[model samples]
Target: MTEAEFIAALRRMPLHPGAHGLMDDSAVIDAGPLVVTTDTLVEGVHFLPQDPPGDVAWKLVATNLSDLAAKGALVEGVLLNYPLGDSAWDHAFLDGLSLALARFDARLIGGDTVSLRGPRVLTLTAFGREAAAPVRSGARAGDALWVTGTIGDAGLGLAIAMGGTGPEALRDAYRRPQPRLTEGRALAPVVHAMMDVSDGLLIDAARMAQASGLAVTIDLDAVRLSPAARALGGEDRAARLAAATAGDDYELLFALPPDVTPPVAATRVGRFDAGAGLSLFDTAGPIPLPPRLGFEHAAPR
Candidate 1:
């Protein structure tokens, strides 16, 4: 659908009180200490048509929640932009959506839904209240780069969901990506800057470095990856590189001063330098990162 047509269709649904009548490029919600993030997933781009409808529902919600989790935001409320499908399919999708939303006691505050004549596209604008806004430019040099749990699972999970499966252990990684909500909140007060690893570790770390005007040197071997990542992710080389660059692992990647340790379990993967660039150190000299990074849906499928 055209942009205007899409907007018009969505505006017909029940909207948030602060959506400004669905006219502007921004929404003004009354959520105090608001932390806002919007994410979009398109059919044939974000997910395959043959994939289970329940999983589509789950990942759709998980991805949006991941953005909120990255910002250290609680699930205060959400505005969903759903491209309505068959009634039975919609019913099942809501069931899956409910499962994921219930995990954080979050609900759809208000949103717009409409029937689309083409592939399904889902957008979620989520908001959470924070006592203080956590910005990305707060990271500092000498601050430790930490990752909660493992990385590369979601990428591998996506790989499995597509068709090729090196192992079954990777299914949960793709189907249900958990946002590090607790870890984000715990570090917000102490950490310099925080974001979830929705993209590859290398890319996200570089983003933090660029935003903070610093450099990030990652210890590739120090990265945390699941067994499946080691297996299907090209065993050794792919594992390291994919762990370095694979996107969609919704774990927390945060920065903190050298002396301070996170109150939660984390792995120190790297350090930020005073300069502005990304270096991956894996026993040898640092490896330069490419510019075309992260998961881009608008690009070629």
Candidate 2:
């Protein structure tokens, strides 16, 4: 089943009210002012089999933290689920995990480790305290869509890691992702809706729109591409389109009033409307939607 279908099935199952019916990126526990999110990375599914253990560990933490960031939550700590590897690889993973946690000023509270028989799978459960109410859903018609950081850097970086030549910056972007925690904290009081762009820009935008019960129109030309992505993707409209559809960009995508500027560096890529779906536009006019919006597991056959 597709992820959406899996979630749909979950909606019918018994769950805590704090679960938000599994509709959000993270669960909001009612007992405490805490937000929690968990993410899993398999050896081949999320990362290349030969990827550095340190880099993989860093990404595992970063992705989970990104979810907490979206909730306008302050980093508390993390619980790790580690599968035992060889001594050297395990040591490198711990070093990387330590670096990431220290860089974010978050602690590793505790977790479990086990011996796996097949491919390695790493999991991290991040806990955060709600600084604000946690901006989950509030977007409205006429809200301007904004995104932080340049798009497609990590996508191009993945290409580089797969033997496609590119600048080190692009590779670094993919290897070491930066979760915009500070920016999320700053934007919590301002944005109408906010989410991290873990999928693709277009796909994530569509999700926010759907959550808000509105239509979002994205201007292809308005997206900001990193210098590294532009250099490798070429200087053309198609390159920009490719970047928008490429997943794994952990930037922030938010919506605000048309006239208000975000405190963080961001680009206005689109605007929400009183409709029910998404529309894509280029320099000329409306364009056809791409076949695949972003990464999805177990696509319908």
Model 2 stretches astray by more than 4 angstroms: 1-32, 133-136, 298-301
- The window of 10 residues in a row where model 1 has the poorest summed lDDT is 292-301
lDDT of 2 by residue, 127-237 (tens): 888656445367889999999999988888888988889898898888899999999889877888898888788888998899899999999889998777876887477
Error of 1 at 266 (Å): 0.9
**TM-scores for all predictions:** 0.85, 0.87
Expressed as tens digits, the lDDT of each residue in 164-213 for candidate 1 is 75676686677777777877777777778887777678877888899999
Q: Go through the candidates in order and give the clash count of each.
A: 0, 0
- Give the top-scoring candidate (TM-score): 2
